[model samples]
Target: MISSIIRTMITEFNNDVDKLSNDLTAQSRNHVITPREANR
Candidate 1:
């Protein structure tokens, strides 16, 4: 039972990390694009 609970927690943690990284990448892309557009 304890092992199952730990496994679930790990899965949830990994999912959260994936979502956070995705959001960061999207924000970084927007930042990169916005500066280039402003320069033009």
Candidate 2:
């Protein structure tokens, strides 16, 4: 049971990271972040 719970948590964390990466990629593709802001 503990192992299953840990696996589930890891899967959720991975999914969250993937989603955040996708969001950042989309924002970058849209040119939403300025170069100066990025440098900061």
Candidate 3:
């Protein structure tokens, strides 16, 4: 049971990272949302 919970958590984490990566890629391609601006 514990292993299953951990696996589910990892899957969700990976999904979140994937979404963030796609968003960053889109922003970079658009050349409007820079890292510096996002840091602010």
Candidate 4:
């Protein structure tokens, strides 16, 4: 049960990260962020 709970948490974290990356990509399209800037 503990392992299952951990897995669920990790999955949710991954989904959130993907979503944030997509949002960042959209914002970058409108604005300008150097590759190095985004990398940092």
Candidate 5:
């Protein structure tokens, strides 16, 4: 039960990261957003 809970949390975290990556890519398409800006 606990392991399943952790797995679900990790999956959600990865999804969030993927979305952020997409957003970063779109923003950087204009050559404006920097690594520092993305970290923010």
Candidate 6:
């Protein structure tokens, strides 16, 4: 039972990390694009 609980916690943590990285990537991409758009 303890091992199963630990496994579940790890899975959730990995998911949160994945989501955070995805958000950061998207924001960075937008920042890169926005500057060029403003200059144009």
Top TM-score prediction, candidate number? 2
Q: How close is candidate 5 to the true structure, as a TM-score?
A: 0.75
Error (Å) of candidate 6 at residue 16 is 0.1
- Per-residue lDDT tens digits for candidate 2, residues 1-40, read 9999999999999999889777776776779975445444
lDDT of 1 by residue, 1-40 (tens): 9999999999999999889766666766778545444434
Q: Number of backbone collisions per candidate, in order?
A: 0, 0, 0, 0, 0, 0
lDDT of 4 by residue, 1-40 (tens): 9999999999999999989877777767767765455555
Q: Select the stronger candidate by lDDT from 1 and 2.
A: 2
**Each model's TM-score?**
0.76, 0.79, 0.78, 0.78, 0.75, 0.76
Candidate 3 lDDT by residue in tens digits, 1-40: 9999999999999999889877877886788788665444
Evaluated at residue 21, the lDDT of candidate 3 is 78
Candidate 4 TM-score, true structure as reference: 0.78
True-structure lDDT of candidate 3: 0.82
12: Cα error in model 2, Å: 0.4
Better of 1 and 4 by TM-score: 4
Please tell me which model should have the higher lDDT, number 5 or number 6.
5
* Residue 2 local lDDT, model 6: 100
Cα lDDT listed for each candidate: 0.75, 0.79, 0.82, 0.80, 0.87, 0.75
In candidate 1, position 19 carries an lDDT of: 90
Worst lDDT 10-window in candidate 1: 31-40
Model 1 CA deviation exceeding 4 Å by range:
32-40
- Show where candidate 2 strays beyond 4 Å: 34-40
**In candidate 6, how many Å is residue 37 off?**
21
Which 10 residues in a row give candidate 6 its minimum summed lDDT? 31-40
Between prediction 3 and prediction 6, the one with superior lDDT is 3
**Residue ranges of candidate 3 with Cα displaced over 4 Å:** 33-40
